[model samples]
Target: MDGYRGFLGLLVSALLVGFLSVLFTLIWVLHYREGLGWDGSALEFNWHPVLVVTGLVFIQGIAIIVYRLPWTWKCSKLLMKCIHAGLNAVAAILAVISLVAVFDFHNARSIPNMYSLHSWIGLTVVILYILQLLLGFFAFLVPLAPLSLRAFLMPLHIYSGLLIFGIVIASALTGVTEKLFFALTKPAYSTFPPEGVFTNTLGLLILVFGALIFWIVTRPQWKRPKEPNSVLLQPNGGTPEGVEGSMAINFGKADSESNNEAAARKRNLPLDEAGQRSTL
Candidate 1:
């Protein structure tokens, strides 16, 4: 089972890398050929997809799977939780910057904001994402929320997270489609340019990557497991299950040794084996 999970993990990695590769290919072929900048230019618009792909798509997926990583098992749960929250925070920040860049570019061009289907869904998802981060932090990271509340909200958090991830990917695909339709003039926009093909491929990879990540995260078999004799950690220091099991086995061995010694003494044949006793 573990081996299979490991193989699945490799598949997930490949899918994620492919997603980023396709995304970068689109960006380079369509956007970066012009150059990148933060000021109010077409170049500035590139940040939106770059940050969304790097932070929301790539880093975000990595953040979601921190607990699933086998090496993380040795570390304290709280530590992993911290890394989880931190990665999420970084992604959220980048996503926000992406949004800002889009709005800024639109305003500079005297274009309307939140007017398109892509913008509507994108903005809503971003708002929901920020709220999700807040809920997660309070529920799991801090004692701000009651542990009961945290437990109650946890499943909802997981469910909503996967759903929102899907929504973001969908919005991104639409946004890319919209960009190709609106922005491109050269290479004849209607005649299926190379950039158009790459953009569609990027969108497909996003779906595949999202599915793989969602699968690995939700699968019960892939979840972290406590060993049979795994020790439980507590503030006051507790005895390990492995030590308890070992002690019981040692006690049984000692009892068997004592029993044999007593039987040998009772035989009283120079305290030797049956062969020596028979010879004597």
Candidate 2:
């Protein structure tokens, strides 16, 4: 199971890298066009390509949410299998979107609105992909493991989730801005300017909100008695778990006996029936 989870983590991490790479590339391409003062062609109404891929990415996000639901942890084997299938489907969709976006960017003559769609979809893919990976990794590590291991992975998972959320929110805001202002601005000029200050302000506000949420979620929590043992073992230090305490005690006793025996041997002490040191 650990192996399986590790493999899944690697898979999701790879997909995330691909999605982010393509997304950043698309952003750079847009900036390049803007710098060149290029009025790129309008978005085409080709539903066959964009809608199909977007639909898949959207489904992937929904699948991740279903898979990570708390109730799924205690779900039946059949249900677990279904959830696993959902995760795999997400991974598959992400892979397809990443491939299609790369090809579209490479072959296009000018900047396409589909690039914006790709970026948004890629963000959704990465956010959900990461969440699913962390949940799977934690679910595997938390059982039949020492508290120390759980302590190590728990905060990591939480912080990563918060980051994912921020990314998702940014992607959504960017999508809205690109659609409302970039797509409809020219046609709706009777109501507002093509590049309205309001849209930019909204985008900025979205970024600020995302940043605030990141800060809030990542802030340190005050130490409490009922807090889980893992929380205490954070780098800031709190308290260790009971099982960890027991392991420490047992290890200390073993180390003490070994040191005593070594001291006895150095002093040429008498031997016991088992040919071991009698005393130090």
Return the top candidate by TM-score. 1
- Expressed as tens digits, the lDDT of each residue in 1-280 for candidate 2 is 2244543453454345334433433343343223212122222212212322233333333343343333344455346646655554555565555445544543564454435664666446565755556565445433444456666676765555555545555564555455455445445624665344444444454444444333332333311113122223342333355446456557779999999999988776444533663443
Instruction: Please state the error at residue 135 of candidate 2 in Å.
Output: 8.8
Candidate 2 — worst ten consecutive residues by lDDT sum?
A: 222-231
What local lDDT does model 2 show for residue 71?
39
Each model's total of backbone clashes: 0, 0
1-280, model 1: which lDDT tens digit per residue? 4777675666567565646744664566465347668898888888788788777777787788778777777776668889999998998999999999998898999988888999999889888989999988887887477444665787999998888888987887887788888766787568878777777677777777777777778778768775555443332332223345456556779999999999878887654677686888
| Steric clash count of candidate 1 | 0
Instruction: Show the colliding residue pairs in model 2.
Output: none
Off by over 4 Å in 1: 5-12, 15-19, 22-33, 226-280
Report lDDT per candidate.
0.76, 0.45
Model 1 residue 261 CA deviation in Å:
38
- Could you give the C-alpha RMSD of every candidate to the true structure, in order shown? 9.8, 13.9
Q: What's each prediction's TM-score?
A: 0.75, 0.36
